[model samples]
Target: MPHTRRDHAVVLGASMAGLLAARVLSESFGRVTVVERDALPVDVLATGSRHRRGVPQSRHVHVLLARGASILEDLFPGFVAEAEVAGARTTDALGQVRLLLSGQRLLQTDIGLRSLLCGRPLLENLVRARVRALDGVRFLERHDIVGLTATPDGRRVTGVRIHADGGEQETALDADLVLDATGRASRAPVWLHDLGHGRPTVDTVQVGLAYATRTYRLPQGAMGKDQLILNNATPENQRAAVLAEQENGLARLTLAGMLGDRPPLDPKAFDAFAASLHFPDIFEAIRDAEPLDDPVGFQYPANVRHRYERMRSFPDGFLVLGDAVSAFNPVYGQGMTSAAMQAEAMRAVLADDRDARNGKPLTWRRYFQAIAKAVNPPWQISAGGDLAFPDVRGRRTPAVRMINAYLPKVHAAAAHDVDMSVAFIRVGSLMDRPESLLRPDIIFRVLRGPGRRHPRG
Candidate 1:
């Protein structure tokens, strides 16, 4: 149990980040309230897994990296078991998943890591149910957030102003701390400006990414032993696709293109895009599968990062986490894992603050600094990947150029070297730091150059 340090904490947004934040806040606050604009599903079990309008990308494929899954299990015991019982699929991270990066297929090897595959809605609903069961946590559904309420000095946030979704009456909810987990569409910058504070420094990488997704029910033997197949886009070929087995015995096929090359939603055109991927497995499996839904499209313009730690002045009682702080390119599947890492950092910082038992309020400075550290690695990875394409607009330093050049060789070597494959998988799964990939031993293997190709079974 954590030491109680505050009376109330309010969290904006009830998505993954908000739910995770509220779960941690409940340990130290007497009351935790989550404000969300959407009316979430009442009975997740009865509803099964369905998409909600609040999350536009819910129809797309979502991957819970090994690190994120570990954190979720720690936060909510039996989470993996519960999810599996609910039809979620799990596979040996590197063994049962096919990964084609830079047009090179990685040799399959069991690295003892677990990959959890399910729709975004199912993952969120599982976590939301756990958060709802906490002693001091409550949710305010169908509420529209208006703005922040701060002290007259503008040095501290006192609460938040919100109104019912369909009603005009505004209400102020007071709290000792306010956390923004509203994700990519967060309005924190404008709210901060309204409080007489300067907005945080912004970093943007314009990739102009787009996605088209559809659901299918494939034959039992279609995929054989493989659970997920990911064909990443390379500079030479700016198209990617993923086919993952999801809950309810269904599969999702999402096609992605970068730099204004949008995947078509038309059925024939969608299949053509899938067929154009680096591998033919996705197209082959879905070509004869039962179509469950028409293709849905979503667009992401740029990777945005708000450097709050660099800001000279910030309110004392407010903090931002998750996509509100940094929205990464989703192609790398780092968003949810990064959010989990941030939530863990917040937990550690709050524990230290509680242990000090100081008379002063919680230090927003220390929290934001910790968050920056957590966001740095993933940001570098996703940003570096986006910048790999010459058409993408970003400043590529010498280091980025060197790493991008070396990564292809590494991918090529992994085709025959199991050690190289494991190392790359570990880093990609957020289980290890990116620096591990540059170690002397891994570099030796990578520099060995391309080896004989291992044909896929």
Candidate 2:
């Protein structure tokens, strides 16, 4: 067990990242306060699945990657079982999800990997409820963060100023440590600038991706056999679609387009768009299905990464986690998992800080370095995959070029090879690194590709 540090810590945002941060902080701090602008639902389990105002993309389909589920379970014991009891559907990763990678369907196999499919709001509610139940954790919802409070030298952060919902005056809350987990809209950079510190440089990959989604009610056992169907957008076809089976005989379908190609909101147009994709399974399944809601759309211009690790200096008692540090392409489904991994990294660094006494703090540079390592695999996979599309602009080195070239072949081989498919799923689910997919044996199989077939329209 690690030694306890600080009397109090404040986590900005009640999102997944913030909740995870608060969970970890509870272990080391006497008191941990989570401040959020949005009001949490009173009875999330009874309320069922619904989108939160703060998370615009929650209306779409979301699947918790295997690695992410493990991390969440580590933070909250029996998380998967509890979430399953709350309406999450569990299935073997490859056995249930019909994955089309680079336009080729992976062969069905029992990869032994598992995934929990459900609505984003339900998952967040579960995690939030667990975090709120912790001994040292408390929530201050319906409050807006004004800015970070800092010392005269601007070298260390002391606390934050917040405006409560419908309140005239802002309140000050002090803490020994502060974590910024406000996600993509985070104003941490602006707050740092206000404190006379330079904001971290940002790296971006512009894909101009847009997607639309809607929920549908299906007859019991109508989905039959396959719980999920996905066709990832490839260079040959820069459009993708995914249909995931949720609890209560409902399914969520998401259609993605690239380089200014947006999915329409009309139901007929949405069905037509799904049909237009390389895969027909999604359209076939949902064409005659009952539409529960109108199609909703979301746009992502680019995947952004704040290079905090590259910055030479950082204020004490201040750190950024989750989308505030790096926001990945949503198509990859790495956000929550990546945030959980970052929290794990923070836990490790905090645990190692024996010299955190005498007013000294854990070094942000070292922590950011650890985070950069954790973010690299997913970033390379998602951003590199996006860069495969000719219209997306980014620097591609020889290794990236080589990987992109071999990826199509890999997908082709996975169509017929169960072992190859398992390797691909493992890497995609963040359970293993990209290197696992590039082993000599897998490379040979990809190169040989005995059962390879032509592309399907």
Candidate 3:
């Protein structure tokens, strides 16, 4: 067992990132407190699956990448089994889910990857429950974060100030460390500026992404044996759709478009958008399905990355993780998984703090550096994909250009090559680095192009 290095640690936000941070912090801190502005579900097992205001994308389909599931299992043992017990669907990643990239259908095969299909609420609740069960961990739900509380010299963060929802006065909570896990709209940069520290460099890729999502109850044998269908958009189409099987016999279909093209909320127009996807699988499955809810829309302006590691100076006992550091295009389904990976990075950094025995606080600089390494690959993958569209605004460096040009060929070859398909999926799931896709053997297959048809299960 590791010795407790800090008396208390405070985590901002109660989302996946915040919950994961609290879980990891409990090991090194004597007490961990998570503060959130929204009211959390009291009985996660009973009403946890219902959507909340904070997570606007709750209505959309969410997939737990294989790499992320493995990390969660490591952090909280039997996480996969527990999620299954909570009505989440587990299926062979390649064999059961249809993947279409750049208008090419990847051949089905048992790639040894697992896909966990469940509503975002259910997944967050499960994680929140695990964090809540930890000793000396507590939640301060329905509270608004006021600001950071620093030492006299402003060299270290002492804690945070927060106001209870509907309360008149703000309360100060003292801690040895403060971690900001607030999502895309994080105010950490502004806070740092106020504290007389230079803001981190910001990188933005304007994707102008929009989504329209709806729920339905499909008829018996609607998709035959398939559990999920993802038809990604290409520059030629500029539209995408995903129909995923969720718990409670529900199917959630989310239609997406890029570059100011928005999917409609009108029932007929929504179907028309799905029908116009590269493939008709999603449209065909939901054509006669029973409507469960009205379509909802979400717009994402850009993918933003705060280059905190490049900042010359940062206060001690203060750190940022998750979407607060980088927000990616949702079409890639990398947000939650990226947060999980960042949490794992935080865990590793905390565990490696040899100075903890001397009562030294965590090295925030090291933590940020570790998470930057963790976020780089996924950010590049998603950003590179967005840049493939002629309309997206960003610097298309030679490296990005080369990779973008090669991806189409890779996708084409993966249509019939099982090894090629598995390799692509592994990289997409973050199981392996993107460089693995450039191996000599994989390159050879790409050069040869797709082969004759193969039987698909």
RMSD (Å) of each candidate, 1 decimal:
2.2, 3.0, 2.1
- Model 2 TM-score on a 0 to 1 scale: 0.95
Those runs of model 2 whose alpha carbons end farther than 4 Å from true positions after fitting are: 1-5, 220-222, 354-361, 451-457
lDDT of each: 0.88, 0.85, 0.88
Model 3 clash pairs are none
Tens-digit lDDT string for candidate 1 (60-129): 9999988899899999999999999978888788888889889888898677788799988888988899
Model 3, 93-127: lDDT tens digits are: 88888888899988887776887888999999999
Off-target runs (Cα >4 Å) in candidate 3 are 1-5, 355-362
Clashing residue pairs in candidate 1 (N, C-alpha, C atoms within 3 angstroms): none
Per-residue lDDT over 254-358 for candidate 2, one digit per residue giving the tens place of the 0 to 100 score: 999999999999888888899998877788888788998999999999999998898876788888999999998888888888998899988888877744554
lDDT of 3 at 148: 96
Question: Candidate 1, which segments miss by more than 4 Å at Cα?
Answer: 1-5, 359-362, 450-457
Task: Give residue 246's lDDT in candidate 3 (0 to 100).
Answer: 89
Q: Which ten residues in a row have the lowest lDDT in candidate 1?
A: 448-457
